[model samples]
Target: MKLLLRLATSLLLWIIMMVILVLIILLPRDMEVKRIGVKDHMSYHFTWSGYKENIQQYLADVKENKTLGTSVAHQPVEWELAHYGKRSIAILVPALIISFLIGILKGVFDYRRNRGLWKVLGEGTTWLGQSIPDFFIIIILELIISLTIHRMFPHLQLYGIEHWYNIFLPILFLSMYPAAVIANYTTQALKEEDDQDYIRTARAKGLPETIILWKHVLRNCWSKILIHFMPIILTLLSSMVIVEYMTLYRGMGTRLMEAIKIKDTIASTDTILPIETPTVIGFSLEFMIILLLAQWVNQVIKHFLIPVRKDEHT
Candidate 1:
């Protein structure tokens, strides 16, 4: 009965998320850019047909605007759609998976013993990392690299590393912030779990520290950790915005920023709206899977260490 309820809840969440995704993708992109009435005077906008014609023509020109002097090539509407659809999926899906795995494992290790000092240190480190503005870090790093290269090797082209370094910088920046947060929260959770009576009782039973920490404490805490940390996996999509922009890497973030600043409706919408579909779907599925797996792991651990009737009563 509990398992059935869990499955139903999961289905409901998935349905709600899917509905939101569809609305975002289907909503009128031009609404954000359209001029509304001013305070002094009421203004009438163009008819829907006229607006469509203008926007269509603008989108057409966007593709051919080679002289715009941007780093990225201007893509046609279809190309932009296809490119971003694939890119969002390709980047976010695996990133969420890998980051979650790392976070869960690291969290297990950090929280196993539930040491208070370690928990405080972990939380403090994440808070520090999160407080630093992404752009500030980017600028500082960029200047340091550029200046260091200029002083050491005058012949080096702008920086010491090759162009590939630019690629790695954004990925590293995106990964680091989330990892810090994950480690911090995991540590705190573990520390809290260690204070529980069950953990103390396990130790009292002469269980080895390793088995008590991992087999008992970590297993019980998995559900709480999963619920609390689910959003961490999804946040990478937003983090990429700052990381990619600061590094001047040609990722979706750069393109999206340009689209918004220029008020290019199609470009902006294409980047933000449908592009998120795959990321949403993948993240949703992954989160659900993790929840189930965590719950299953929790149950298995509870079953072996203690009797079912005891667990139920507790």
Candidate 2:
């Protein structure tokens, strides 16, 4: 009953959040005609009202072998949809899963061994990650990287993001914040679970350390870690804006920034499209799927922690 109530509460909060996201995205931007072109080249005027029409015009011009001042219209409808959809999942969803799994596993182990220091480390690490802004970390890392590169190869100047090293630094920095938060919460929850009377009872039974750690400590601490991860995923999604802006990576973050800068309504709307639906389904099916998985995990843990009795027990 408690689990169900918690699930219901989580669902309600998710719905509220989705509604807010929808309102922010759907509110029409002020339309204005602006010239858009590549690399500070010649351009043509288009407004939000005529966005589709302009795309069509560009496509038609290309089909008829016409050029608008060195620009050829190649509307990337299929590419944009496919790319953005894949990227939204690739960046946010997988990161959440990885962080939760690794954090929970290591955290439970650490808590079982070092109850005293784990508390301080867990809380302190999370607080440090949360209190410091992500951009500040990014800038500091960027400066360090810049100095290193200049020292090693003075002739080499990094411009485009074609280099593998260029891509990794930003992703690593952005990911650090969430990973720290997950580890912190996981450790704290496990420490708390370790102090429970049930754990003491299990220990009194002379269970091996490994068995107690996995079956008792981890199983009980999981739900708390999961709950922490849910909001961190949301925070990471929000932080993508800053991360992409700073790193200049061509992910959804960068795409969203580009739309805002150019005032491209279609692109901006497309970028903000929820993982599941944009205008059709009111509920976020993508987020709903995640919520369901979290609930299923909770049920599995509960069942394991408290076994049901058979009729023979009577």
Candidate 3:
């Protein structure tokens, strides 16, 4: 019954996401450029024509299995999605790993200092940071760099987008909320476990704090802790898209945005390409698949661990 419910819920969420993506692609506030004079440009109010054309073109392409129209060269929609998806995976996987490590370690660190200082410093800091949304994090960091750091050291060398070191800032930024969430959960989980008879007995037996944490409290509480990773995966994945788009990183998000944006393909003829529907749908669907897979993995872990939890209690 629970399995059926979970499946149904997931399917519903997936459908809703697909609907939203299609709307964003098909029902946009469309616009075109007009010349006020030779060099000046004016924005024209949009019409339903742009929307109609996008849907018609998109359907025709789907029927014919046509190539994506956004790129300069002829490229299959599948190829564009695959290429950019791989690039996103390369950057995001590292961010995911780093986020997990930071969250787990920081959580453990906070758990160890669970009294006095932990309440004021650990709890306050973790919850506060976690409350702020992902986009704000990126904006805050960008502002810090632009307003303060860039002004302070006007000639300081900064890494370009493609530079290896450029990956670190996004990774670090992405790691923040996940880490804070994990840390917060870890502290609470450890606290709950600390009140257990086994943990109390171990403490009464004069065992060192480290041994009790690693061997006893954790052993009993690890299954519960595993559940937290489920949400963190989603958080990290979504944040990867946002961060990549905001920074114009060469990833799936950037590709999708670029395709959706209105651009003049030919200045001579003033030819405009409509939103790359195939490319947009392709990337959005690919991202949804990855998200579904992560959710499936999380469910699998819970499914396996539930029996162990029952046995332990029995």
Measured by lDDT, the strongest candidate is 3
Model 3: per-residue Cα lDDT over 91-208, one tens digit each = 6777777766776667777777658977667677777888988788778888888888789988653333666566666676667778788777777777776676777787899999
Number of clashing residue pairs, candidate 2:
0
RMSD vs true structure, all candidates: 9.2, 10.0, 5.5
Taken over the whole model, the C-alpha lDDT of each candidate is 0.54, 0.56, 0.71
Summarize candidate 2's per-residue lDDT along 1-314 as a digit string, tens digits: 77677667766776786656544443433333334553222234435655555345544654775422120124343344346445545556655665666566556545554547775564555667668887887788879878898789986644335574554544565577787677778778766665667667778999887887787667666566655544675666777667766766566555544433432233331232222212112223344545556655555555444443112122
| C-alpha-based local distance difference test score of model 1 | 0.54
- Pairs clashing within candidate 2: none
List the candidate 3 regions with Cα displacement exceeding 4 Å: 1-60, 66-73, 134-160, 262-273
lDDT of 3: 0.71
User: Which tens-of-lDDT digit does each residue in 23-116 have in candidate 1?
Assistant: 4433443322332363232223335675456445544554577321122343343454345445444445555556656666666655543368
Among these predicted structures, which one has the highest TM-score?
3
